[model samples]
Target chain A: MTGKLAWTKIALPLGVAALLLLAWDAAVRVSGSDIFPRPHEVLRGIIQLIEQGLLLKYVVASLFRVTWGFTLAVLIGVPFGLFLGWYGWAFQAFNPMIQMLRPISPIAWIPVAILWFKVTDKAPIFLIFLASVFPIAVSAIAAVQNMQPVYLRAARNFGLTQLQLFRRVILPATLPQIITGIRIALGVAWLVVVAAEMIAVNSGLGYLIIDARNAGKRYDLVVAGMVMIGLIGLVLDLLVRQLEKFDEVRWGYANR
Target chain B: MQANPTVQVRDLWMSFPGKRSGEQVHVLERINFEVRQGEFVCIVGPSGCGKSTLLNIIGGFLRGSRGDVMVEGQPVAGPDPRRIFVFQENGVFPWLTVTENIGFGLLKKSEPERAKIVAHYIEMVGLNGFERAYPRELSGGMKQRVEIARALAANPDIIYMDEPFGALDFITRLKMRADLVRIWQSEKKTILFVTHDIEEAVQLSDRVLVMSKRPATIQTIVSIDLPRPRDLDSAGYLETRDRIFSAMGMSLRIGENEKEALPISAQQPV
Candidate 1:
């Protein structure tokens, strides 16, 4: 029964996607446009990318940048969030700055990133890091502040030391929200990476799309590139969603 | 001097700053009490009468402005592991399963020791098949059981509970009271429980400390003097329950026996 359910979960979405692709192919054929690529043309364009080995290189380049930027955000943001959450004065002092920076889109920083890093890898990486850190840090702060006071009382009553309380109670109590924040940050980082690749650097799915359309009017390659990005993003989101199944953190995600 | 009580509070006063400027709202005033070793004592009062605030002071979670709370002959300064709190099913860690929560305080112990203690409490609470379940998977009564088990597994000498069964339904509350009595008989821990339920106090406690309305002080300490497996419908039970109600300024002699000379509203409080 479980196996069948799992099979259906995958098969149903794939079936719908195939139907959508067929409809797109039919629509393009009926329009009789020489410029518009059919589903088969898009497939051939992806095959061309594979034969040239650009697919692996571009996909890996994009993924590698996202991974490092997100990892750095987690490292810096979590501790900063814990500090801000735990201390009243720190939160009060730093909260205004966080709020101010949070609203500015990472895409808007492209020019500064290019100027500062001078068209190197650092430019796009910096943009991705900036896109992710605020959400990660702010959510962690809210998680700590929103914690039920009873948990702290119980932890204290059980004779946990200050450090132990942070490790045992505060971390676990705020973990579900922290995980949620990280997921949101990862999404923003992924989004910023594409835009960053469009101008700040080259050789990612985003650049593949723009370069295909501009250099040779290869709209087929552009559509293929978009499909790859969507598929990869879906897989990344699914992986993060799996974390919500943990027993300790499952309660927070029950309603969701 | 006199056999050192498990807990003792003298002239306890607690006041919080009111919403307005330069105004204070007194929660507990001139509160005084003592719980002997192995005693199961309940502080009963109307809602919002500072009974919980008094418990917090005695449990070392809060400080009384002008009084002393001594525990084991030492001035109560902060929360001690020896005095664990079982907060109305709210203290059980949600992220942890039953086994994990019960073993939480025993993190410093050996793995085998922690496992054994956790297993014992899980069985003691009658959660035989739910050893791996999380707090959200359990009922209100079951959640309270988990909280109690966690407290007991820590091997605390004293357990303070604040309205532990207030959120539970009538049937579950009755069952929990009985379960608590059974555990207390076997374990013999000093328990200081606060509640607004007169019957609950009379049924579960050896002595019920009834408190008056806001700026609350202990009005009477009525000894239950009832046998184990208490019958809630028994005449003695009704008498003791009525006694606590009377001390809280709600008498039973109003409509049936005597004329309603004093309106119940005049006697009882919000």
Candidate 2:
């Protein structure tokens, strides 16, 4: 029964997708639509795109854009969040600007990214960083703010000085939330990297898709790049979640 | 000669500003008490009668509105490392192991000394096997024992416990009270305990203080005067319990009608 149940879970989603693809295939053949290609045709094009090395080139470029931008976001975001969370004046002052800039879309910043960094890879990197930074940072800040007052009081009652309190209590408590934020931001960075690359960078998965489309061939490369992005993102997210479990077991802070 | 007193409160007045008015509402009014060195004094009153508030004031965690509290003749300004406080709430930090929690206050000591103190307290508390275990792994009673061990390990001049067993089940609370008396006798340190449990106050205290309501003040101080190893069911113990209960506005007159009840000794402290 367990084996049969496991098979059903996989079969359900697969069956739905297969049905959708069959419908899409039938529609294209019957209607002669140029926009929606048959699943088999897209799969076949993927093989050809790989043969031309076009698929590999775009994926690597997009990966590079995401990697650099995500790293910069974490580097800046974590400490900025910590500061805004820990200190009253910093939170009060920075909160307004944070909320304002946070919701602004990465694509919307394309013109300024081009103007400010001006056609260099930095422009796309900046755009990806813009998209990723706030989710992680804001989550970290919220984590710190949500800490129980008793935890601080208990530390103080033990006669810990402020620095010790920060190192021993605040930092440890904020870590899980910060990690959650980083995972979320990393996902956002990957999502925006394609858009950023299509506009700014000369190469990447996003570049590969757009470049393939511009070449008037190979919808397969675009589909291949999209699949790779989703698969790679799932792997990265899984890695962080596993790390969170390890921390939860070791630290025993949040009881999760 | 009587043992020297460690704490002396002279006309201690503690009040807080009222919510909507300019009035200074009193918690303990003109409170004066002295804890003899090595004496165990438990303050018992109704729940809102500010016994815990007075304990906080003694620990130097709160300021008196007027008058003074002196320990070893020095006035208390804030929480003194010399006086350790064990609160009723789970006092042990959940993240720390039993050994780590016990060693917390002893951080200022030499490493060898801290290790020695931690080992000693762990043994005394019968938690030797669980030294490396986290507080979350321990039961509520076990956690309270760890708190007591930690407080004892600090070797403070006085230990203030605010209903340390208040959260425990009945059997556990009884066991803890007995354990506390044993520790107090062995260690010979001053203890000022706060509880609303009349039985606990009567059983453990060298003196039981009962406080009246808001703008609260000590309504009476009744010395147990019974021989230690105190017998809670003994004649003197029953008498003392009745006296304190009476001070708390409960009449044991119906129960007191029983023939040949223990005679309560109320010595007017000069």
Candidate 3:
């Protein structure tokens, strides 16, 4: 019965997608214009890119930028967040700057990033890092702030030392929330990577879209790039969602 | 020299500075008590009467503004592992399974030793089949049991519990009280439990410390001489329960400051 339900769940979305594709095909054919690519044209464009080896290159480039930027963000953001959450004075001193910078868009950083990094690989990577870090840090801080007071008291009463307390209680207690923060930041990072690539870098999925349109108006390749981006983003989100299912972190998701 | 009480609070006074300048709110006032080794003591008071504050002071989680709390002749400088506290059911760590939660304090021990101790407490708490379950999977009663087991696994001679079963439903509370009594009898740990439930105090404690309103004082200490598995409907039980009620001014038409001893037989359903 569960298997049947799962199959239905898969079939339903596939059916909708197929219908959308059919409508797009009919619309393009009726217009009698080749400006807008049909569904099969987009598929053919993808196959052409694969044969040319550019699809894998562009995908690898985008993934590489995202992985580095997101990794650096996590490494810096978690500790910075824990520090701010642990120390009140530090939060008070720097919170205004963090809050001020958080609202600015990664796209807004494009001009500054290019000037700072001189159109190198570092510019888009910097933009992605900047875009993702604050959300990760803010979520980590919230995670620590939202901790139940009883856990700390219980930990201290159990004779945990300063180091032991953080390692045993604070770290484990905050991990589920931190993972959630990282997941959110990963989404933001992926978004920033594409936008950053559109202006700052010359080779990525985002670049592929602009290049396809501007180079020769290859609308089919442009549509193919969009499809790939959506599919990849969905897969990335699913992978992070798996982290929330871990036994130790499962409690956070239980009530929800 | 007489051995120091298993737990002692000497002229304890705890207050915190109020939000307004030069203002203070007295949480506990001139509280004094001692629990002999292997005794089960419960402190009972009306809601917001500072009973929990008094327990925190004795447990070394809070410092008294003007007094001393000594356990085994050593003054409480800070929270110590030798005196573990069991909080409300929420005290059990949600991140840990039953075995891990129980073995938390025992982590410094050897693996085999920690396993044995964790297994023992899990069995003692009647959570034998659920050792691998996290606290989210447990009912309120079961979570409290895990908290209690966690405290026991620490091997603390004195366990301070703050409203440990207050969140449980009526039937669960009753069962927990009985389970606690059985555990106490077998373990022989000195327990200091704070609660607002007089019936629970009467059923489980060796002595009940009745406290007054805010800036609370230990108004009276009522000892229960009844046998184990106390009959809740018996006249003796009802009388003791009503006496505590009357002492707390919850008896029919009794004022909050009423001090006059009342005849137990005169008690009616409040």
Query: Which candidate achieves the best DockQ against the true structure?
Result: 1
Model 3 agreement with the true structure over B58-86: per-residue lDDT tens digits: 88878889988888988988888988988
**Candidate 3: stretches off by over 4 Å:** A1-4, A26-33, B1-4, B19-21, B252-270
Q: Is candidate 2 or candidate 3 better by lDDT?
A: 3
Docking class of 1: medium
Q: What is residue A55's positional error in candidate 1, in angstroms?
A: 1.3
Model 1 clash number: 0
Predicted candidate 1 versus true structure: per-residue lDDT over B243-263, tens digit per residue: 666666665764553332467
Compared to the true structure, candidate 1 yields what TM-score?
0.92
Clash pairs (backbone) in predicted model 3 = none
Write down the worst ten-residue block by lDDT for model 1 chain A: A247-256
Stretches > 4 Å off in candidate 2: A1-67, A247-255, B21-25, B108-113, B251-270
TM-score, B chain alone, candidates in order: 0.92, 0.90, 0.90
The segments of candidate 1 whose C-alpha lies over 4 angstroms from its true place after superposition are: A1-32, B1-3, B251-270
Q: Please, what are the lDDT tens digits per residue for candidate 2 over residues A115-183?
A: 899778899899989998999789878978987664665566667788888877787767777888888
Winner by TM-score: 3
How well does each candidate superpose onto the true structure, as a TM-score?
A: 0.92, 0.82, 0.93
- Whole-structure CA lDDT of model 2: 0.82
Judge candidate 3 at residue B50 and give its lDDT. 91
Give interface RMSD (Å), model 2: 3.1
lDDT of 2 by residue, B117-224 (tens): 899988888887999897767889999999889888888878889898988999988888888888888887788999998889888988888888777788889887
Q: Candidates ranked by TM-score, best first? A: 3, 1, 2
